[model samples]
Target: MNNKLHGPLFLAILSTLMAFASLSTDIYLPAMPIMANELQGDIELTVTGFLIGFALAQLVWGPISDTLGRRLPLFIGMVMFIIGSVGCALSTDIQQMVFWRVFQAFGACTGPMLARAMIRDSYTRTRAAQMLSTLLFIMAIAPIIGPLAGGQIIRVTSWHAIFWLLVVIGGLMFFSLFALPETLLPENRVKISLANVFRNYSMLLCNREFMRYTLCLTFFYVAAYAFMTGSPFVYISFYGVDPQYYGWLFALNILGVMAMSLVNRRLVLRYPLENLLKVAVTVATIATLTLALVVKLQLGGIVAVVVTIFLFFSMNGVIAATSTTAALDAVPSSLAGSASALIGSLQYGSGIISSLFLALFRDGTPWTMSWIMVIFTLSSITVLLRRGPLPENRSSLN
Candidate 1:
């Protein structure tokens, strides 16, 4: 592998790498209904199992990248990803698919965390934030087209094709890994120590500012996963929308996300990230609360729910980038890999929690999804308002 890649190529590679996580989730969603019907198991658990693997793998990949360097972990992850995808494609039952999805997710989550970690490796705080906004903007293409593509594939073929497509994607990623530079410098490497990983997390926990933003970011992911978990059922089962069109709806929301991200990228040139964050969260909270109410009252029906969902999702464009940059700003650059890992773990951890809530409480209503979004967004807002700005310092790692 090259010790360094040209800048444009690096960004492209990193964005695709990170985007794979969302790709893993969104691409398979359209298959959920048919898969559940065919395999005679809970559709919800299949998604949940994948998410659990995706979320938890950060714990291992992030720290290992810190010790072993970025490229090796990514290569390992890609291999595992292909194996998992193949397993999913060949699955005979929901249980087997769920287990394989976990393996797949274990491989998938590494991309985004490593992408962020690598950004920290190559740039300063503010610049890294800008780069992240750009990366996420490009990354949107995966989720944007994923379900739509999945829907089309399912229409033309079967759900099994989706995993086979994933297998191809993972294979391509594996081969492309050869071109990516090892962004982790030797001086920056942490000694391979379980104790060191444990200690790094403790340090993150103690940082008040980081924790505040961390909570905010995690809640945002919770809201997203909640939406993702419930939407197929709500749209297809409850509203009678065609499964073929689910991707179109999801893509429309992502367009809003892209627009907001572009707006933030331009706005960040003139305004502070904190100021923008406040406005974004405020808008999201209001939109989500209203969504919950509309769901409860059953007032405007599916159209209303869809509009409100879009409003809530649009805010994530700002929330994800700003909140991530804000949280990472508090820690030393040296611990970027570990910090990125911790953030990914917490984000997915929140997703798992949110998904579980949907499984337990949802009764084929969009209300469960709406309420969870409201709860997570409001909680995020409260933290920002109450916690205030944190004092920056080097990590306890040194």
Candidate 2:
């Protein structure tokens, strides 16, 4: 990597790009009810639409980035994102909102997907892990800030302002992105073709070590997104938490993420990544189980819900950085884009499932959220422990 592109500013730009997905979703979450009442249809459509676009678009962006190099595909995606954001801000009905949300996500997915490839292009395994941790640490700030700022914005203005705010963010980040050097060298680039894309992805799908980590990471994301999809309604409508105060509670969970990210950054130096991952998974399982127990027994009220959710969400700090690094490390450098796309596509794709689960089984309580989290957490743990390649055997397996 160029020295000019390996400083704080470089990390900031990459992290900001990565934050686009979370920023676009979290900022409008507090105002979802307002949007729903005014728009007169299922507001969950916005979330589901974004998740679908985010999930599927990465497949295209990843291959295109690999072929064309990262910068061109990235700039094009940002332009799409900007146009979509403007459309969202001007939407007159739920149908239009859903369309633009999907469009916005099509562009938004490029940021994180390509950012991961860029990181892989720059560093080896351990260094990549550390840099990813640091990237996540910076990126975590968006979730902390988004809902808080969103809550205040909705108090005085319509939810349209929220999309406008996203437009401004997209514009600024689009310009800031120019400073990032193209990490994928020309000599390393591959040709873009449907057959080529299919073959590369097929190769990744058959790699046991790669699939294990990717699947585990995808499960964790599903669990967390399930919570995100349902929490606003659970907290505000069910528990009567004020919308303005929702972000404060949300920040607590994200703070847990930042704290755990820092811890993972240090622990990676002294501990095997597998060990760190195991412990994180165990802790996450326990937290979700406890949350289920709390919500079932009604022992902790909202206090218990927040604390347990905090613990469950905090493990994201370790799980996301470590699992992603591990999965990417299992593949040849040429496959980084496809690996990232596969991982991202599945992770976000599961959100649609989570959203549908809540939509169908929800009973106006927190039970559906808790159940989905538990199911996915258990699925992740099972994959990591029972199916994942053993540490000593990973080299041969990959």
Candidate 3:
């Protein structure tokens, strides 16, 4: 069944599955202020709650997928996602919205977590990096479209319509899986047990190469997630940009992502992915530092902030794809699901921290956002540099 699937269709399915997280998170962002006002609660809690659920649920899904094969767990997850979206649509207050968002994430996390494992199931290390970059290139369109659609929906109807739209997306994906072949073979299945789950996860944590690569990407992602959480306030609230036009500025960053992912597809053929990862992180750190300074000094107002933020985000094209590919490559094939989950868990976990920072430092300015981005990008670079050199040839865990 897997053999019969065409490449482009297969990529589209996986990309949409992975893009589910972004689509879920970004679509309601344009309505944050209005939602907060009407619901009499902070809308940011919904994002934090979703991240918390998204982070922890991946641990359960990853190992379950390894045991049960990919398709069954995904079917279960999509149903949960659809139900959660409906719950969100019907929520009467921010607390209810947050609760349902968390529930929605329980199902949504399965998409990207399994998507990475599925990619690993099909490709070798270098090929996986290239394929993931291409997948990201396609998936990047979600953020570009999400907020635009959200803003329009709000203008005509209510923020509740956004969740209704997500319900439709979840339903389509649930049906789409019928065509997706189960990638995990019977021969590759591991027995489900508490002891085995702990052992496999322990082995991954003890692998220095895996941890280094994982943390490098994870820290860099803190910056990106920070941008996602903070940008609406910075652009629309602080700078007084109209809510409808907010999507245009947001689209600029995603266009940079698409451009860099396109460049990465070509560059991977000529350069080692590890080297590319290092260079991308360094460039991202520099851009973030400049952004911090620009916002602190009020250097060029919103133009400087947007340009620098665009440059910083563009590096995600290379950093995210290569780092995941390299980290999963450090482990055995059977651990791919668990490895993907741990990577995702750590990445989304940082969002909780980002949300907290914004809340604690709620200054009605971009200061907190800019600094958080800089600090995390620097942390990623520090992790990458302090690790020193790697062996030209390394052994994977047995």
Q: Cα deviation of 201 in candidate 2 (Å)?
A: 0.9
Off by more than 4 A, model 2: 192-194, 387-398
lDDT of 3 by residue, 1-398 (tens): 36644368788989998898889989888899898899998788999999999999998898888888888988999999999999999999888999999999999999999989998887766677788999999999998999999989999998999999999999999998998888888888787684577568888899999999899988988888889989999999999988888988988999999999999988887998778988999999999999989888889999999999999999999998988888888877788889999999998878988888887887999999989999999999888877755434233312
> What does candidate 1's lDDT look like per residue over 78-179, in tens digits?
899999999999999988989998998888888889988887777656666678889889899999889999999999998999989999999998888888
Which lDDT values do the candidates have, in the order given? 0.84, 0.89, 0.88
Please provide, for model 2 over 1-398, each residue's C-alpha lDDT reduced to its tens digit, 9 standing for 90 to 100.
58855788889989998898899999988998889899998888899999999999998888777777889988999999999999999999999999999999999999999989999888877778888899899999999999999999999988899999999998998898778888888878776675677578888899999889889889988899889989999999899999989999998999999999998889988988888898999999999999999999988799999999999999999999989999998887777888898989998888898888888898999999999999999999999996643343123211
**TM-score for each model:** 0.95, 0.97, 0.97
For model 2, what is the alpha-carbon lDDT of residue 291?
93
What TM-score does prediction 2 earn?
0.97
TM-score of 3: 0.97
* Steric clash pairs (candidate 1): none
Quick one: how many clashes does candidate 3 have?
0
Off by over 4 Å in 1: 1-6, 192-194, 390-398
